[model samples]
Target: MTTLPTRTDKKLGLVIDLDICVGCHACVTSCKEWNTGGYSAPLTDYDPYGADPDGAWLNRVHTYEIANDHFTGTVHFPRSCLHCEDAACVTVCPTGASYKRAEDGIVLVNPDTCIGCKLCSWACPYGAREYDHDQGVMKKCTLCVDRIYNETLPEEDRTPACVRACPTGARAFGDLGDPDSTVSQSVNDRGGFDLMAEMGYKPVNKYLPPRKGTDRAPVTNVAPAPEQTGSPIEKLFAWADRALSR
Candidate 1:
């Protein structure tokens, strides 16, 4: 039997490719499905068809319109628990259920150890953690730790369902510690930026910025027609040109 190496040191995390994301909500839906069935308590929806349906979700996608004087467009910002390097959620947990993995650097809540106190949610700025009312525990993204290391699953299918389900291929899962990894290279080459950088969360995930058109395409005015000094037919053509220009 092949043994899996323990993720010693900070394996780092992800580099979400915002450029490729199409805001399809595949990741969101897939995450809900996986977490709902895999964990002790799957996601639950309250009044799903009622006046105000609400449910617990560890991940969400937000859409925003950003524009300057000359350009206008929409940016789809996917939000989830960043799994911060200095996660306050871990410290705030009185029962020690919320902990960060020293091996891979993933922040997780052990349902067995959790005491149902939502202090971890209070400490989170991104609102990534969700309270599981059924199990009286806190739930958040595990980065598919159980699936990734499962020997029964195929190697290619070991990643989180969100990463696998993303139709646009916006999400990536790998060791950010490896400088040469695709995630790290994308961050370095495209200049990835963090959301709410002032918070100093030091999120393991890096968000790639949206792209824009080049500045080389310039707009110019057409020259006016010369004074007409020919037959009425020729003069009419010049007048039409001037009118079209105006």
Candidate 2:
């Protein structure tokens, strides 16, 4: 019998459409739930239902309001690990735990080799790496490697939980190396852009452009023109001028 090809040797990535995102934070919450439950370690919260709260979250959505003469808009930016092509996080790992896969190009952490050094977190500018205090190591988005290959899970549910939980359907997951993938097609069609592209991290994630000129409503509340008014002083001046002319 001949061996069939498996879904491997492909670099997967995400394309987030900010224009249609409703800012519900479903992706953020869902990610927390999945990682905290199934991963090697769960995200820890310092305080729950207390005066102040702190915890680890792989993803966060930021809201921005941009106003200008030519355009006005509201942007919902869902931020997470960029999984850069030139990932500094991979190079700084002394234990060789943080490494990139040459086959699929996904950055991952091998917990067994990690020594709990904090250098990798500092090397990443996007703040993607999270310290796993319980495991005595660092953790981050594995790009849902286990779920994507799990035969028990339905074929339709093979992607990251965040992508699945997105109510607005703003998140896309697929092979970035394949030029024909849906993510690549969308990026070409809609003109997707990278965040902090100048840094040359070459993030695997892409962002859809914000809707143009949709921030504020039209200028309907403009001040009404001054009502037809002739003050007493104006009328007196006019009368005096008329009399002097006569």
Per-residue lDDT of 231 in model 2: 91
Error at 133, model 2, angstroms: 3.1
Model 2, span 102-169: residue lDDT tens: 76767887877788898989988888888866567887887777777779999998899899999889
Instruction: Highest lDDT: give the candidate number.
Output: 2
TM-scores of the candidates are 0.80, 0.80
Record all residue pairs in model 1 with backbone atoms less than 3 Å apart, i.e. clashing.
36-42, 36-43
Clashes of each: 2, 0
Give the TM-score (vs. native) of candidate 2.
0.80
Error of 1 at 187 (Å): 0.4
- Model 1 scores a TM of 0.80
Error of 2 at 122 (Å): 0.9
Taking the tens digit of each residue's C-alpha lDDT, what string does model 1 give over 24-137? 889899888887877535777788899998878878998888787644677777788777876778888887788888788888888888998898899888888888776678
Error of 2 at 101 (Å): 1.6
Error of 2 at 26 (Å): 0.6
